[model samples]
Target: MPDVAEVRRRTWVPGRPVDVLATLGPLRRGAHDPTWRVDPDGTLWRGVRTPEGPATLRLSSRPALGEVAASAWGPGATWLLDSLPALLGAGDDVSGFVPRHPRVVAAGRMFSGWRVPRTGLVVEALVPTVLEQKVTGQEAYSAWRRLVRRHGEPAPGAEGRLWVAPAAVTWGRIPSWAWLQAGVDGARSATVVRSVRAAGRLEECVDLDRVSARRRLRAVPGVGVWT
Candidate 1:
């Protein structure tokens, strides 16, 4: 694995490599090595080894101003570390945190170092969230991998992660036929299209309290609890 400290030491533009980690957390979720890579332009990368075979990560951080927010989720401590900053309010007190589940707590301690991590926030989450509504995890993720791998740019560093997601302006330009090919039905496609227009405002939710942030996100025409 590459050196994590070395990657973190580089300077970055507002919207690329630095922010991808800021928003997505570790791309491998709860792997032992737990590494992420960033292309100079901000596209993110990671590697995984499942029982079936090895895998790699590549995606555009697609960050917007104020979009560097992340959320706690999944079955392990990893997400908590990455998303806690947003759930409890950025830079919150972890002293009172006590997990009800023993394993999750143990996992939390294991990954505690990233409590304030950056998960590319903004359009990164926004794009996926828009695709997830009223659909199974399978559907949304399938669409994301397809569209991004096809239309998104390539990663830009020594590492080989996928490129970042398209810009809002670029998202809007994705033709309808492209979404169909990616297996996104019309409704989910529409949400993504509209979200591209409101990318900036949507990311601002990261700055608000979790309740307020989620509520505000729901205010978007197509955004709801499912998103």
Candidate 2:
């Protein structure tokens, strides 16, 4: 088995101390499993469950690396931290959103990892949306895994196939036969193909506020309120 330290080196950060050692706790859930788990302490930990055991990539260490991960994941997390004190400070009651989503609200005991990615949002979120135009989620996720494993890059940390979702350019170039191998049909494939051509346009949604982002996302060729 490889050293956990070696695996740790590949935590996928951009090399900035502030990002690596965030002021608050890790908010990225499932960072330690196939799903990234964000700890209450704000430690964004990503783990690769090896045959030997679990190899963890913790963010609270090595300030420089953490900073990079922070930025690469999108530097908006810093902004979230700044507003957190005001939102949860003295006399600030947040029960409205808490009771609605008890699990998330209660578990969210920190002020980091809230900012969603901009480009990857378009890339990763679009995976299911593109493949699910007229099919089931199982079919879409399955297709995502198949195609990513085939055409996507290797995940920074993991034993099995953790996909680095193909970029827009790559998506635009994927052949139709590849889609079939992943169980995706022509109609859905066409939508993904068309959208990939306008990757920049989809990424533009990231800068907009949540409401506007969703609004513009819906305008994308294959994306919709239901999709």
Query: Which is the leading candidate under lDDT?
Result: 1
For model 2, the local distance difference test gives 0.48
RMSD of 1: 12.4
TM-score of each: 0.57, 0.52
What is the lDDT for 144 in model 1? 74
Residue-level lDDT tens digits of model 1 in 89-203: 3443567888989998997766553444444356665776677667776776677777766665443332434334555777888999999998888887887888778877876
Q: Give the Cα lDDT of each candidate.
A: 0.53, 0.48
Give the per-residue lDDT digits (tens) of candidate 2, residues 1-227: 44322422223333222333233222221222132445576555432222123333344444433532221111223332222232122223334544447666665545333322222245445655667667765665567656755775543444443334566777888898888887988878887877777667776775678898787776766677776
Question: Which candidate should be chosen as best, given TM-score against the real structure?
Answer: 1
Model 2 residue 94 distance off true place after TM-score fit, in angstroms = 4.6
